[model samples]
Target: MLESLKVLDELRLNFSQSGLFILNLTLAFIMFGVALEIKFEHFKKVILNPVSTLVGVFSQFFLLPLITFLIAILLRHYITPTIALGMILVASCPGGNISNFMSSLARGNVALSVSLTAIATLSAIFMTPLNFSLWGGLFTEIYSRTDASGLVRPLEIDVGQMFQTVFILLGIPLVLGMWFNHRFPDLTKKIVVPIKRLSIVFFMGMVVMAFMNNFDYFKAHIKYIFLLVFIHNAVALTTGYSIASLFRRNATDRKTISIETGIQNSGLGLVLLFNPKIFPPDLAIGGMAFITAWWGIWHILSGLGIAGLWGRKRKRVVTIQ
Candidate 1:
């Protein structure tokens, strides 16, 4: 499998410059929609009730990436370098915007979910790059010594460029949307739902475009990608829940943290991967692209599935009472 997957290092996805622009815009728009739901009150909630929020943040930005690196190391012989790095990148991303919806559906703490999302996004401008660089660099360094195949390239990422890209993509829109929401409360309320719904639609369209453009590559390698993502995502969800439980959090908080940690901002990962400045076009990081792209679709399915099960379980408990 590792030998077969080596071909992914040389495979390039069919994304053009214009498509990259659209993807960036779509991600920005989604972030803006996410900001509409955030307010000063959410931050205040964090200040007053910091335990769960901090746990969620720690679980996501700290533990997830570390766990992913360990998983990559354990499965080193079973996976390629790009695939391992792809998992690291996704783990390094912030929680997904859709997690709030899934949390609500699962009868979890929606306020905590939103708070975690806002905090994670803000922190991601720094944490994403830091975690990815730290873990990715370490992974390559460790494996390069043992594997003489010359496949492991040094993780040569421009931290300054990444910081700039993350700020422009996430920071600016987040500030603007939050400001707009603060200034016009009534309008924000009226438009937030539609914008959130539309953002999800646009993001799904972006995923569809990615699949359409690289259908053949995805078709050939999706089996391996699927299994890797499945295990990785399950670990993420478990990490969140286990951390929350270890901290003695309530059931709702456990659910919220689990969902938040499980559903990563793979859309952001896609944008970063496609950015020529961050990752040049000539670099054959197709495995990274495939993992990031498939992750965007799979997490949604997994999140919703888990949320549905939790919802049904809650309803059954309520009936018994």
Candidate 2:
């Protein structure tokens, strides 16, 4: 498994500067769409009823990264250093923009979901870089002592560059979208749905293009990647639910918190990974790119699958009652 995964360290996906620009635009547009759902009331809701929100924020920004580090440590022999760092990067990302949709489908707390999304996205500018550097640095230090191969690169990140990228990609769009919504309520309502639908199509197209370009590498190594991502995603979802439940959150909050924590903004991770300034073209971090890209696709499937089950179970209970 480690030998197969090691090949990813030398691999580089075919993505042009133009393609990268488009991805940045698409992700920014998606963040804008997410902000359309964020009313001032979402922040107010979090402030007024902070328990569930606090639980979700804690689970996402803190516990999830901690758990991922522990998982990487425990599974060190089974996975490569790059793969482990990839998991850490994904964990450090904020909740996916689609989590609100999944929460609504699950009959969970849509308001809370939206609120968490807003908070998480805003928080990510600082937290993503902080968490990744903190955890990635620690992982490399610990792993360096165990491995004789010297594969682990010094985990260096330009915190200023990352903050700038995230702020541009997330913070600016968020402010603009919310302001547009606030300024033109009627127009915001008319365009939000179409913008969101278009954003999803564009993002998925990018992911498919990435896969097509790297089909051979993915085909050769997807089994290992698949299993790693599947287990990692499951642990994330379980951690969210278990923590929420431990805090005595109700079922609705539990479901929403779980979805929020589990569905990470891996698109952002991909964008960061592709940035020459942040990751640099010389870095052998293809494993991080693969993990981030696949997580973008897999989380949607897994989130929808779980949401569908929860939705059906709710219908059944209602019928029984």
Candidate 3:
């Protein structure tokens, strides 16, 4: 079992230049669609109730990273170092693009969710690099003493390069989308939905295609990865919900915060892992690859399932009343 899992550490996926371009474009499109849903009024509203927004931010940025490191410490004996770092990377990332829709589905505060998304994403531009580097360095030190076969890469990040990528991919598209939406509200409403649907389909399809290409390898080794991601995601959701409850937030804010915390931008994680300049193909192969890729798909399923359950429970309570 150990050896089989180790094979993942050396197993490299084929990534073409055209594929990288497509992936970059797909992520930019997704970010743009997410931006289309944001409005200046949403920021104003978040500022109006700063407590909930602050709590959500704390849960996502600081609390999540702290807990993720704890989780890595606890699991260090059981899992490879690379796998634990993958969890850290995902935890450090911002909220997923669909968080607002999921929050609304769960009858949560949609505007608050959108506001958190905007803040988290912008913050992630800097925080992601910082958090990943710090936590990843710690993981490396601990693992170096524990295991001879290193499962992770050198913990160096080019801050300037990362900043440039985030600015182009996330910031530029966001600014453009916001401007377009503000300029043509009706057209924005009509096309935003289609853009979202198409981008999600394209993104997910490409991810699945790449993973499925090595079906046998991944199939043989997905059990442990799945279990790790499940636990990590649970921790993330609970952190948000617990933090919000401590602040005495309402039920809607609690749900929104929980969803925002749970659904990370694993897509961004994947892009970073795949970036030749960031994590080399060899260093990104096993635990990192599996964890982020599985996370990309699993979070959507888990988020929707949780939201559906919340929706159903709320409906039942209303009916009873």
Model 1, 1-321: lDDT tens per residue? 777677776787657889888999999999999999888899999999999999999999999999999999999888888999999999999999799999999999999999998999999999999999999999998888777764544677687888888989899989999999999999999999899899889989888876686687778878888999999999999999999999999999999999999999999998888888888777778888888888988999999999999999999999999
Provide the lDDT at 299 for model 2.
95
lDDT at 39, model 3: 86
Question: Mind giving the per-residue lDDT tens digits that candidate 2 earns over 1-321?
Answer: 988898998887646889889889989989999999899989999999999999999999999999999999998888888889999999999999889999999999999999999999999999999999999889888888887865545676677898899999999999998999899999999998898788778778767766676778988898888898999999999999999999999998999999999999998988888887888677788788888888988999999999999999999999999
RMSD of each: 1.2, 1.2, 1.6
lDDT, each prediction: 0.90, 0.90, 0.84
Whole-structure CA lDDT of model 2 = 0.90
List pairs with backbone clashes in candidate 1.
Answer: none
- Which model, 1 or 3, shows the larger TM-score? 1
Highest lDDT scorer: 1
* List of clashing residue pairs for candidate 3: 8-286
Q: State model 1's lDDT.
A: 0.90
Order by lDDT, highest first = 1, 2, 3
- Inter-residue clash pairs, candidate 2: none
Cα deviation at 82, candidate 1, in Å, is 0.4
